[model samples]
Structure formats: C-alpha cells, structure tokens
Target: MAATDRAEYCGIGIRGVAIGIDSFVWFALLFVAITVTGVVTGQVETGAQGVHTSLSGTPGSIALGLWVVLTLGYHALCEWRFGKTIGKALVNIRVASTDGSAPSLGAALIRNVARLVDWLPSLYLVGIAGMVLSDRRQRLGDRLAGTTVVSD
Candidate 1:
C-alpha cells in the first residue's frame, strides 16, 4: 500500500502496540478507582470476608460497570471532538474509517460495542492477538465496522 494508505490504516503492528498501551492505561485506571473506592467505603474485608463480599455482589462490580461506561463515553466524545483518545493523542494516533475520514457516530458505537468480543475473558488478549495478526491491525470490532486506527 502507499504511504498515504498506510497512514490511514493501523496495519496490525503499530496498532497492536497502541492497543496494548491503551489497555494497560485503562486497567490501571480501573484498579486505582477500585482501590480508592474500597478505602473510602472502609469495606476492605479479610479472608473469608472477601469471598463473601464478592459473593454478595460487591460494590466494585457496580463501580467497574460505571467505569466501563465512562471510559467508552470518553472515547466516543474524544473521537468525535478530536479523532483520538488521550492515549491516542499522546501517541499521535487517530481512529478513522478506511477512507481517511472520521468515523460516524454509529460506526464508533458499533466498533466499541464489538470490543466485548475483542476483550473476551480478560486482559484484552484476544484483541491484542487479533490486532497483531490482522492485515489492518483491526480487532473484530474494527473489521466489522470497516474502521481503522491510524497515525495522525
């Protein structure tokens, strides 16, 4: 492909690293949020208490769900406003359609929702693997949506 095409495409290799970095940052943020919530709530339990706590539907699950929503919202808003997430902005990368245009709202939402498949199980290993192996560095979502992440 031409340099311009490459610039407008993620090409598996580069996008893999970017996705890895993004996942690490997101997980770190989630961890911090959970820790802070625990501290604030004074609900830190020990041994069997911890097991029981989880069995009883821990507040952490609610917080985690909220975090997921907020994170997706941030990504959607940032991509709409600036074509990148903070991490993507820092790395000079942007998410766009294959035609070198910003993705539409429907496309963005579809891509992110498909992230469930990309993030299967945990740690985003599936997404990372797919990105590394795919021609366009796309996870399942990007493939399905005809979108791409590119260097801006």
Candidate 2:
C-alpha cells in the first residue's frame, strides 16, 4: 500500500462548534420523537398548571429504545456514509480514516459507540480533555476507530 500523508487535524474550537451543532440536531430529533410519542400515547399531559411527561410502561420503553438507536445511528451512519454529520458539514470538517480513506462502517461504529465513554461526567468533558491531550486532536472515539477530524 502507498504511504499516506498526515492529515491536518482540526482544532478543538471548530470541532467544538461542529459537535455543538450536531448535538442540537440529534437531540432535537430525539426530543421531538419522544414528545410526539408521549402525546400520542397519552403519556405526556399538559394543563394550565404545567406539562408532565410520564416515561414509564410501554411508552417509556419505546422512548428509551428510540433514544439509544437514534443517538448512535445518527453519528455512526452519517460518518460511515458521508464522512461528516450535519454539524461537521456546516463547519467544513470531516471524519476520515488515518489512512486517508473514508471511514468504514466498522470504524464509524467503533468511534460513535465509544462516544458513550467520551460523554462521561458532563457535556463531552472527557472528549475535550482527550482532544487537548492528544497531539492528533482526537477524542477517545477517533483514536479507537483510527480516524481523525480534518479540514474538508
């Protein structure tokens, strides 16, 4: 195989913005889905007093399942197929294999699944720490998946 040139990794600043955008997209989707599901199932009650959401029983289970699938699938599928999520596209960055190819499905899954770990203790504090500490500007997911976030 031919040797690939090193990638110019994106800084935490831009990456942060990209993730912020992506977070909004996926979380919004999840929120809407769960909200509609709750209302449709009579699990979400709104009155003059306040709004109450009951995420228990079948409806709760469905919401939980949707949360897991949508969160994981959004990142994994987008990176695997398009090399970037909506947020990354907006910021003009992309995730690519260190070998200078598009990230494979396996790689995207590994990275996005690892996102659970990266999200520990707060809003991506661990991921930010990883990016700060690593010379390659990678979070845990990127390192495990052998991928990098680079200029598009």
* Clashing pairs for predicted structure model 1, backbone only: 12-137
Question: Highest lDDT: which candidate?
Answer: 2
RMSD of each: 5.6, 3.3
Cα-based lDDT for every prediction: 0.70, 0.86
Model 1 residue 12 lDDT?
A: 53
Displacement of residue 145 (Cα, Å) in model 2 is: 0.8
Model 1 worst lDDT window (10 residues): 48-57
Model 2, range 4-113, lDDT digits (tens) per residue? 25557887899889988987887787787688778878888788999877677788788877787787898899999999999999999999988879999999999999
lDDT of 1 by residue, 90-138 (tens): 7778888877778887778778877877878787777777788877778
TM-score of 2: 0.81
Estimate the overall C-alpha local distance difference test score of candidate 1.
Answer: 0.70
User: TM-score for every candidate vs. truth?
Assistant: 0.67, 0.81
TM-score of 1: 0.67
Cα deviation at 118, candidate 2, in Å, is 0.4
Top candidate, metric TM-score: 2
- Candidate 1 segments exceeding 4 Å error: 1-8, 11-13, 16-58
